[model samples]
Target: MKITGDHQLIKKINKYLVLDTIRRQFPISRADISARTGLNKATVSALVNELIESSFASETGLGESSGGRKPVMLLFNERAGFAIGVDLGVNYMLAMITDLSGAVVKKKRIDIAELEAGALTDKLKKTIRGLMPHVPASPYGVIGIGIGVPGLVDDQGSVLSAPNLGWTDVPLQSILAEEFGVDVVIDNEANAGALGEKEFGAGRDVSNLLYISVGMGIGAGIILNDTLYRGFSGFSGEVGHMALAQDGPLCGCGNRGCWETFASEKALLVNARAAYDDAADADAAAPNLDTLLSLARQGDPEARRLFADTGRWLGTGIANLVNVFNPELIVIGNRMSLASAWIGEAVYETLDSRSLAFHRSRASVAYSQLGHSSAALGAASMAIQRFFSTMKATWE
Candidate 1:
């Protein structure tokens, strides 16, 4: 007896396959796609025609042919739609707009003051409203919104808790989706950063990588075999709370000796202020990351030492992660990436000395290639992924 396949599912999958193929290898002919994906020429032709009709793919002219008439070449219509991605930090928010292909078209960053849940929601609404008009006239016009928050988020797109933001159980996803009338995605900033790196930055070349976002706090985004590992309950990457010393500085999470208290940007500032206070230095006009970075650039010994110490601690935590995960690459991202010149050597030295030689031998470390844009871009990519998965290309 013969069996029948689900025609709609098969068509969706085939269309998606053809779209993805064009996106990756555009200026390609349908024959090439048939060869690459092993779909029949007629099926590929039908799917490509449908994609062209949907404005997702376009003919770019004829291609060079060996004998017969030149075949028409195609290009993925990246500008056919746009997406919004937001990286919400404790003190700042960076919003960006990217085409379907993940190329940033516009971005804006605003400093955030202390605000409660209600006020924060209002602020986010305003920000989203502000970005909507600049989305560039496209077919899908802001297909969706993706946000990376520096906290825990449930699978439902709600921000479970953002301690630094003083937010807990905020139904941010629903709020945004309702307000904007578009799909919304919410995830931990570290996870977003990791995804961002994996998709478009340094980790693109490696299958297993760890993206560590070090800002006011430190959190990790684990990628195992090219996939983001969110862990049980969608609340992993809280490496900040990893205890380092039996007795160390108290963290806001009600724990002492947490990794962030010793290695994060907050840690650097805290130590900087203390050092300046101890020395009675007149330059203690409130040292933030910028000030410390300037001091280091000016060859301040104390600043150098402070950065070195932070790097050493960062290395210690990373060494522990390396031994456990054995990832091919560890990307240090977020606010701390700005201090790469000052802290890189120290981090490498410490990681080398602390990690097991066998594990250390295969793993390499690098700073974020996307710089501050990692989370935002990654968030946009998440939105894009959801869009594709739900857009008739998936069962949903």
Candidate 2:
């Protein structure tokens, strides 16, 4: 026996297909959409009409014709809606607004030395509230808010644990939704970085890759077969907590010898401060990542060596991942990327020597192209994705 379906489901599916086709290949004609989607011309036309009527698609001038009247070109109205994305770091908050096409319209960064949950939430609310008015009066206004936190985010958007930030069991999504009266999405920052690169940066062409976010801490975003692979518990990308040394520096996760303990921005600063103090420079200002980076840029041997040491540690972890995953590419992102100039050689050197010959040869590592905006833009993309999902012609 065969099953029958209602027209609503079919209509929703078909309309989504048409919209997706146009979104991907804009300046597209309805005739081409009909051919590509295997839907008849009339169905394609009807769907296109729906999208245009809903302000999702708009007609441009005529296109080149094939033995008939010039077909009108259709354009996806990216500016019809706007989305807000936030990248909440251990010490900073990066927020931005983007069109549906993921082009950033505005961005701001605020630094917070401490991560008290109340203060953090208040700041988050304020940042988003400030951004809402700048949304350019689109059809959906500020459609939704997407946040990337450096922690384990469950399906319900509760941040289970972010040790570095001292956060746990925070219902971030619900809190934001209730406060702002809009949809909210929260995910691991590394995962957001991976999505950012896949959608707009270096990893766009690769299906299997890893995004390593080396910031105040470290994490990995695994993309397998063009999909973000959140593990069985949505905690897959906590690569920073991976044990590297049997006895090394204590990590924020209360573990010794974790990869981030050696390779993260926090580690770099710790080492920098210690080294400076050892030199008996009591009058020296606290050395931060930016100071060390500037010193390295100015050819300070000590600063460069510090970065090299960190790079070597980063490479060791990456090599392990390369052997295990054999991904097509590995994108090193986040704060560590800022030191790529100083650390590039050491990372390459370690990977070359340590990683399995086959895996190392197959996989290539590079820094984030979007720099600090990777997670923020990616979060925005998630909000944009949800906006479209909720508007898929679900009619009565």
Candidate 3:
């Protein structure tokens, strides 16, 4: 059909409505899609045919019919394309390749001591290249790459500052895009984590949610009314640097008593190290988080106390979030969530005491459903979203 103007817009909208309905309710029949989307049967059929021809959908056998001929069911072709997602942490990098449906087809994690921008970029390139060999050929093979970084990322995907990695004003997105010859997206790790949870994890059914990433540092991804609330300049959700204590410990962000300085995995480790240093066997090597968790599990009083203290601090920060945002759900993610047993109690206790009664009563705190994979998966999901949006525009 030679569509134009308002008719073309309507056709495009109806096409995507049918596609989305099939994606969500597949294996759904054309009649079902038409009914769900309120589009005419002929329009739904035409869109489905186009999607199938474009490899974005498929006929998935027959479904039960309400009398009359058996209806052919339609399914979204999740394997039509792939996306790469990378989560760059201070001490580690996680990379994954996901299909259009956000299923991780392959993934890898690499630990690194290097923090120089060049070194990190090289490492990322190498990792992505390794995954490329495994990507199956499709209509849009490796549509794009999305990266989640532990730093302040501007709209142009520049890392303005990442104190933990000593990176500043690095054009990470452009660098990767140039290397791979594909679109590249970069955002704060917490924001990616929030998107991950909202689309595929704990916050799947909740519109208003908070994803708190408590790792070497703390950051939050705010979801208000089912959308990521990136402020102007895309530098929102740097809640870790929010000052909580005027005379508290120094933070890497050149701030005193930042929330992360008290509630982060770094704080937990510091407290654990302090406890071990004061022990009778002071010569023992400082314990890592896993070691501390083992000690806490084995009923080490000092280790348990440290986790509880960290949890209390975490709760204080969460209380502030609850009062301010009143999110329906708050997801506590990253490495610290592994020690939920020791930390959860103190978190609840502190939150109960600190948060406003109304807000505290409404907001339920939970651990990340995707655990350590949230950021990486979120990046892949974002890439997939971008790809579909572009595809919809082309149809329009």
Clashing pairs for predicted structure model 3, backbone only: none
lDDT of 3 by residue, 1-396 (tens): 555677988877788777778777888999998788888889888889999989989997889979999999988999999999998988889999999878989999999899999988899999999999999888889999999999999888899999988999999988998999988889999999999999889999999999999999999999999899988877889999999999999999998999999999888778777778878975754678888888888898888899999999999999999999999999999889898999999999999999999998889999999979999999998888887778788884
How far off is model 1, as Cα RMSD?
A: 1.9
Residue 178 CA displacement from its true place in model 2, Å: 0.5
What is the TM-score (0 to 1) of candidate 3?
Answer: 0.96
Each model's lDDT:
0.91, 0.91, 0.90
- Write the residue-wise lDDT of candidate 1 on 103-189 in tens digits: 999999988895688887788888879988888998878889999999999989888888777788999999999998999999999
lDDT of 2 by residue, 203-301 (tens): 999999999999999999899999999888778989999999989998988989999999999999998888888776535636788888888888988
Which run of 10 residues does model 1 get worst, by summed lDDT? 1-10
lDDT of 2: 0.91
Provide TM-scores for the models.
0.96, 0.97, 0.96
Which ten contiguous residues of candidate 3 have the minimum total lDDT? 281-290
